[model samples]
Target chain A: MVNRCLITPARTLLTQTINPSLRNGFPAMTEARVLVLDADPLPRLDRLGARARVLHTDEKSLAERLPEADVLLVWDFTSDAVREAWPGPGGRPVWVHTASAGVDRLLFPELLESDAVLTNARGVFDQPIAEYVAGLVLAMAKDFRGSWELQRQHRWQHRETFKVHGSRAVVVGSGPIGRRIGLLLGAMGVRVDLVGRRERTGDPDFGRVHATGALPDLLPEASWVVCAAPLTPETHGMFDARAFALMRPEAHFINIGRGQHVVEDDVVEALQERRIAGAALDVFAQEPLQDSSRLWDAPNLMISPHMSGDTFGWRDDLAEQFLDNFDRWYAGEPLFNVVDKKLGYVPDH
Target chain B: MVNRCLITPARTLLTQTINPSLRNGFPAMTEARVLVLDADPLPRLDRLGARARVLHTDEKSLAERLPEADVLLVWDFTSDAVREAWPGPGGRPVWVHTASAGVDRLLFPELLESDAVLTNARGVFDQPIAEYVAGLVLAMAKDFRGSWELQRQHRWQHRETFKVHGSRAVVVGSGPIGRRIGLLLGAMGVRVDLVGRRERTGDPDFGRVHATGALPDLLPEASWVVCAAPLTPETHGMFDARAFALMRPEAHFINIGRGQHVVEDDVVEALQERRIAGAALDVFAQEPLQDSSRLWDAPNLMISPHMSGDTFGWRDDLAEQFLDNFDRWYAGEPLFNVVDKKLGYVPDH
Candidate 1:
């Protein structure tokens, strides 16, 4: 059954009235009132003013206005309002979408139990993350960091570096991001072992797609080990002392996955002891890692502040995806990218 | 008919009398007296004892010893012995293989006219060069350089980066090295445009292949422009002022090819003007690039001492390749990776 709900059109009316001066060829959205909970105001909403009412609010004001909205667009991922206000009086907004993957911050007991639809920005990050992983693999293999340091000192020391082709790699995660990483490395004649929840036949040239249980055997043979897995009960702290111990002393470890999946202290120890060659870490268990953290002093380590998938024009892509999803919903078609309450994706697992 | 040559039993007797240690497994001209003219000794050849006598000589000794050797293995790439002495020899060796790629130093008129076969260490570098190109592409796109700087300053700034997938790239050169680079990037979902010497049918991924003439059109559209072309009359200084101007302002240029292909001053001007985003250079017109060079101060530039295709087991692989070629030669079978004298490869073309 399709959920139909009425929305108060004040915000939509205000947005429509303000749009013409801002954008050229602005499109009108005339179906429902859309409440945007974003830290910064979106100027593109002016284009959708005629068909839809757009209201802007922060976390504090969201709960009071929850009942009147027909849809909730979570643009401010840092806010927890979506979780707190989702179980409001008029049976929650018919649909809710976050402009980010991993809806951990927006999940609440009440929202999880509701019939409201949830979707995420999944496809947008696949390529960027894959590219990041490839870069790290190359950087470590070529010793770009060492070369850069040498250049600064005006040193002309020529040293040999490792090669990516004909090397073995293990990409841990079967989602879009991990699959893309595997595909990129595989194209380069690298033997890639992809680890997923379960083996699937449709995957591309993956040497062996094993379950998480096979990681112990796979780690020792890999020349480059990458963690692109999600942060879940089974995945958290998965790359601990034991995993690092299993890897070849010359192997490089990279993490585009959540920080908790790797124990930071264990990684520090491994790098200090040269158990593993080096690592490129984008995410951390804590955001804005404290300046005093010992990871800064670890040899051969690269730290990026959790920005692997972000790219120019990303927001525009997210908005376009949602608009396309909205059109599909209005036409009585099954919504694409529906998040299953249990699996946190569409078609309910 | 294929050229046929034979080694007499007397010559083999001379090798056995001078050096018996080379009889076991020394691959390169085991039954020949060899001369190494480099300042540093070839430690790699230490195992090739009695059957192959290695004489470390200066210009004077090299001039005196030129008449007796069965082969000349040029480990000192900077020396001009082959160019000066080949014509003066009583019985010059039948073969000469340089440890370096460019034959300009040894390609004297006398050697060119002689029956002496010449080869370069070509296969050993193909994968490593490809890997280096991949690293530069990833590093530029991910802003890895900027992130490293931020880390040094103890700042955690999250910035956006571009994805490699669905992005367009142009790899100039169709040799084993360039082809491998294309394959690696293609695996990452990038639509790679490969520019070769000339366009042909029945080639791998024929649809994406382009000729050198297409550079003007291809440059602007390429998000990442990789220069892997060999140094030739046409390729020398190919990526100069006009080439830099044609690129998209956001595009990144990487040179794994000869440094002569790029005009250093023009590159500096382009970088200074921000007409092109950045570049990573592993080669230069003058290596051990002058310490006073202005390129050091150029914004968004990465420099390395031309060690892209070098790795730890590289010499071992070269030895293995030579042995395989030796087996083919001894068995009167067609040799693999034969260099065409005119095209600098065995007439596979």
Candidate 2:
């Protein structure tokens, strides 16, 4: 049955003549095995053709199957099974790719030190996530929640809402997603202060990209503070009590990066105490956030499932992106969106 | 007692020399009596100085005071008392300035037939209403109402949302308010078709402005259809059953122009039958929509109490705008935003 599912394409001759992997002692392209960490609604890998052997495994079987594959496709990106199964494997794949922008789940010490090249779906989520963040900013400013509640009561209460233009924003992270967010907000007439890992001056769009260290000064002045940084050791819990405390009472915070990037308790406290105007979290420390979580009922809070970048047909986008990278891998070409394992993200030049 | 509130400034000396109304059989600028139709939290007219006598009147007293005033300030722009009392007992004011963008209420036959020059609060609400409309567009596209419902239930249901960047919009009304809406939506990467009374091509921002007659063709292609046209005889009830039928099933409608621009029953029917995806109405066929209205229960409908343009400090912005025009009126120079009675709006050049 497995043999019938695999293709015997005419490209076998092409692989032998031009493929550089043969010179590196790697298996012939046709013999390369790809193990996809299976999740519900599996990826469409029909484009792989007969160039590679494909296998599927759940968390329970991943470790046992790791040694048999030349490449690992982390299709269930939300699972941390790879971190646990990496060490138990007899030998790891030469390449590991995740269907997500963040490489945090695969950032275990062993993987970071391994010879495997890690790649991510970095560009896929940038525009969609940026749009989601902008929507949250506008939602909070316009008090749509209040309007919705009033609509339910069939009341005609007229209230003045805030204006989005002329507002100030502090976008934490200089990546494509964060920069895109900055650009969208700037287009809406917002004054955007982009904060990255280090200070960068003379940016054509933002004029000056402030370093993470400048966040303290930027926080108090910003009406909208967004977190889109990678979940590195330096960024984990970056928006803790101290960071939330520095924000103005009327400031709003939006988190679309990773759950660990925020200390959930601090956000709940801020909302409970009305220290901040409001907060919107598309991610949580432990998601599916427990039903008993206090964040659920936090005042002036908006909680959405981790779907900021999941626009219609996004799965297809991810699958197509992976196929393009697969084509490059089959041709012995360097993969796009290769993450710097130490940084846990694809660093911008 | 009213004289105590009036300013007896040196401007009275300057008024006689430059005021052109004096030559037109109108009252001298300094002798002008201003009647303000009052509402709660009345306007600050301290800037009017000592040049004119300012009198405040409610609906009951408006008719009695109409003949005594040479200028009328429609401070309570929502009142229709002007329509009912216009032909009652006295001559109308030489000039009427409404603190609102829409002059639908002041467009009564008597006012339109009279020589009274009408001006509106045009530019004040342009940016704010545009932002409000943009927010509604984003809110609908992102399914924020769904998120809020899920959040209330503490459910984590991940769903794909629609993208806004590539969407199309049809913005009715080519006046400043409509143009501003088109520009802002255009900046957000939406393809906007600005519809006016006549077809206009080669517009710098919008290459072509479709005539109102083209709405049938445009509605089917638009994901967002906005109504910002003046509520003239030709425009009243324009968004009727036939118009709603032309819209795509996934298209959303937003009305911020005037309540009468839409036929309430048609909108309710469109939402009830699910003919349209959704709608947001800042202005309804009636203000302070009654608690018993059927529109309150319409599906996929968002209703606000006509506060789209009333952003924070908006009243102050209105007052300041009127004062600038009042300065022009006092100097006998042409006033900004002077309405064309025949068109029922400030005609664009």
Candidate 3:
């Protein structure tokens, strides 16, 4: 079945011929096996017709086929099957690409410590998530969600709403997503202070993203605190009770990053105790947020099913990003958006 | 009680003393009655104490005291008392200003034709409305409203949403509010074309605002179309069946303008027939949107009271704007935001 999916088109050959120096002693460019762990229809790779062999594996069969592929594409980004499947592998795929911004689920010890290279679909989600964050900030301030509820109830409630202009925001994560959020908010007249690894210089959008040490000080002044950081050991549960406690009672928190960055219980407690005004959490510690979670019952909290950046045509963007990298892999060129295995994220320059 | 409110301090004198050449034959500024049509707490004009006589009148007493005041401040902008009281046989205030952007309710023919100069709180509402329009655009594109509803229901349903970046938007009204909306949307990678009275030049915000005539051609191309125009005979009911027909089925309509700009029946029918995707209406022909209105039952319709521009400190802003103008008028200086009486709205330069 997998053999039938191979197609060797002229474009693949053209790429190999153009970069003969990269061909070296590498495996045949047109015969590389491409395994995709897919939950939905993957973007068509007919352009690589017979040049790259493709295979789709579900969670059940994912482990059995691990060693048979030259490259693996984690199309089902929300699944943990790759991590579960990697341990029993005879040999890992030389390259693994996840159709997601974060590689938390795919960052198991075996994969991180292995010789395999990791890349993620980064740029595709940057503006979409930024736009979503901007939307949440406006919606909450205008009490638009309340307006929607009133509309549903056929009530005309006129109330004074908050202002976005001149308001202060501390956006955690100085990556593309956070920077975009800061820029968008800043354009709307919000005073934005983006928190990253260290104080960044020469950044046109955000003047100087403050260092991590400043988060504690920044949190106290933020009316809108946003978390857009990548998940890693050092950053895991970074927004714990101490972070939540530092924020003003009127402040709102939003998490569009990996759910692991926040302590769910601390947030829930904050919401219950009215430590924070509200939150619009698109990511949670566990998604498809289980019915048993106390978050649903918490006051003034907005829960979304982890799709902040999952805009339409996103799958196609991810597929095209992977295809571009695949061509580079065939030519043995350096891949784009390569994650720092030691840092477990794309390290900022 | 009204006599006690007057206080004409020397800051009033500073202007009069400095602009002596301009204060020719004007009525005694110290004894001038400043009648404030107040609904909520009026702005403390204590600075003008004893110099300018002040009277606070509710809707019931407004007509009785209309002839006594030299200047009228329409602080209760929502009331129709000004229109109803204007036709009474009494002397009129020489200068009248409404603490609202649009003065539809106050634009009676007698007042329009009268020599009384009319002004509005134009700049105060501009950015607030622009911010609201941007919020609506992003909310609709990301289906953030649907997510809010799901959050309320405790449902974890993930859905495909649209991208805001690279999307097209046509913002009606090239005034401060519309230009601001165009600028904000453009900042987020949305291609924004602003429509105004005539193609405006030297507009730093919107490079060039398309003439209102171009709206017919521009409507079909927009993914999100925003209306922030003033209500006037030329603009009334412009978004009728023909306009709705011109829009794509996927396009979303948002009206932050006076409700009269849209024909309620046409939009409802369009939404009902699935001719248009959805609408987020903050204004209606009759607001506190009547329960009997079919718009309430219209699918995918988002309704909000006419509070789009009414932010937290908006009242203070409106009051301060009026007070600034009052000082100018006392000095016999040409009042700012003076409406072109013939046009029924502020005419663009």
RMSD per prediction, one decimal? Answer: 6.5, 6.0, 6.0
TM-score of each: 0.85, 0.92, 0.91
B43-90 per-residue lDDT for model 2 (tens digits)? 888988876778999999998888777678999998989987785423
Go through the candidates in order and give the clash count of each: 20, 1, 17
State residue A238's C-alpha deviation in candidate 2, in Å: 1.3
* Residue B264 shift from truth in candidate 2, angstroms: 1.8
Tens digit of per-residue lDDT, candidate 3, span A1-349: 0001112332333334334454444446447778899868776677566658798889999988877777789998889998778844446677788988899897788888876778888788888898899999998888888888888889999988888999999999888888889988998899999998768777887778798899888999999999999897878999889999999999999999988998999999999999999998888887779989888878889888988998888888889888887776675556677777777777654
- B138-179 per-residue lDDT for model 1 (tens digits): 888888888888888889998878877788888998777787
Query: Which runs of model 1 end up more than 4 angstroms from their true locations?
Result: A1-30, A41-50, A86-91, A198-208, A345-349, B1-30, B36-60, B78-81, B85-89, B197-202, B207-213, B327-348
C-alpha lDDT of all candidate models, in order = 0.73, 0.84, 0.81
Highest DockQ: give the candidate number: 2
Total backbone clashes of model 3? 17
Where model 2 places Cα greater than 4 Å from the true spot, the runs are: A1-21, A24-29, A87-90, B1-31, B87-90
Interface RMSD per candidate: 1.2, 0.8, 1.1
Of the native A-B interface contacts, what share survives in model 2?
Answer: 0.75
Cα deviation at B207, candidate 3, in Å, is 3.5
lDDT by residue (tens digit), candidate 3, B130-194:
88888888888888878777777878899989888899999888767777788888987899989
Question: How does chain B of model 1 score on TM-score?
Answer: 0.83
